[model samples]
Target: MNIETIISKIKNALGEGVDKVSDEVEKSQVFEKFEDSDDKVAKILDDAGKALTSLFDTIADKAEPMIKKTKAKIYEGIFEEYRKDGSPYGETHEGFMQWVDEHETEIREKVDDGITKTRETILSGVKKTQEYINREVSKKEKPSDSVVDGSSVTDQKSSDKE
Candidate 1:
């Protein structure tokens, strides 16, 4: 199945478990004894559970695509290395060792390039998300300010009437 489907299944399973536990806790005698204490305890448990769930969701969201990309790159690198030697494996034990030794620099370069590109891509995405959020916040604030300004004008007009 696809990553999104897998993630959704995981989330649903976790949500069901959370709901079951919450229901059990709500039904307990301990919760019946002290209403205020039960309220606070329930709130704390709910908040902590939600936070943990969110953390796992974030991890899964980030890891799925990264794992796929890394797997593809590793396969590509191995295949390309094999092709260069003109053999599926290697010519000989010594030949394999020599190939590895010779390609150390190139392999390192490719890994470094991949890391740099991945970092830049993640950063760019974060920047774009931040910009979008900021734009939305500004849009919301402008309407709020307009409402306050209108109220102030109405208040001043009333004062001037007096």
Candidate 2:
């Protein structure tokens, strides 16, 4: 039914029946060999995992300060310059507000001029558009009794007279 029984029967048929102690010894040796190899594989894997973890940790620890320093440098270069010089605008919020106050009249004049010009241009365009629409509507509304079915207003009138 099982491998051991089959082996035993075959051995017995060959007149070399297996001893129980010998079978047990062989099974124990094979089991121990398997266990030893398994332990070895587990140790190797554990060591490899620890080494990889340590490598990544070391890389992260070394890179953190450099990354922070780079970010600080970039911020300093861009924002610090703007804070100092205030290019086309102003340096700070108060400075920007003061600049706007100083130029308030000029800004208002330019905006008013732009709006007036835009309004005049739009009014002229609208007048021209309305004239074109009116011409088209009048043409369609005016009656010319030129019949599409080969009869005219004069022909119908003459027929009625008859």
Please, what is the TM-score per model?
0.45, 0.32
Q: Kindly report which residue pairs in candidate 2 clash with one another.
A: none
Candidate 1's residue-wise lDDT over 1-162, tens digit each?
Answer: 764454455447667554343223323443345467446656776899999999989999999998998979875775567577686346665666566677788777877888899899999998999999889988774422223221232344455579
- Please give the RMSD of candidate 2 to the true structure: 34.1
Model 2: residues with Cα > 4 Å off, grouped in runs: 1-34, 80-162
lDDT of 2 by residue, 1-162 (tens): 875875576558657434543665565453454476446656776899999999989989998998798657654554444455454465665765565576568656765776689679979998999999889978886534435332322435555579
**Lowest-sum lDDT 10-residue window in model 2:** 144-153
lDDT of every predicted structure (CA atoms): 0.66, 0.64
State the TM-score for model 2.
0.32
Tell me the deviation in Å of residue 162 in model 2.
99
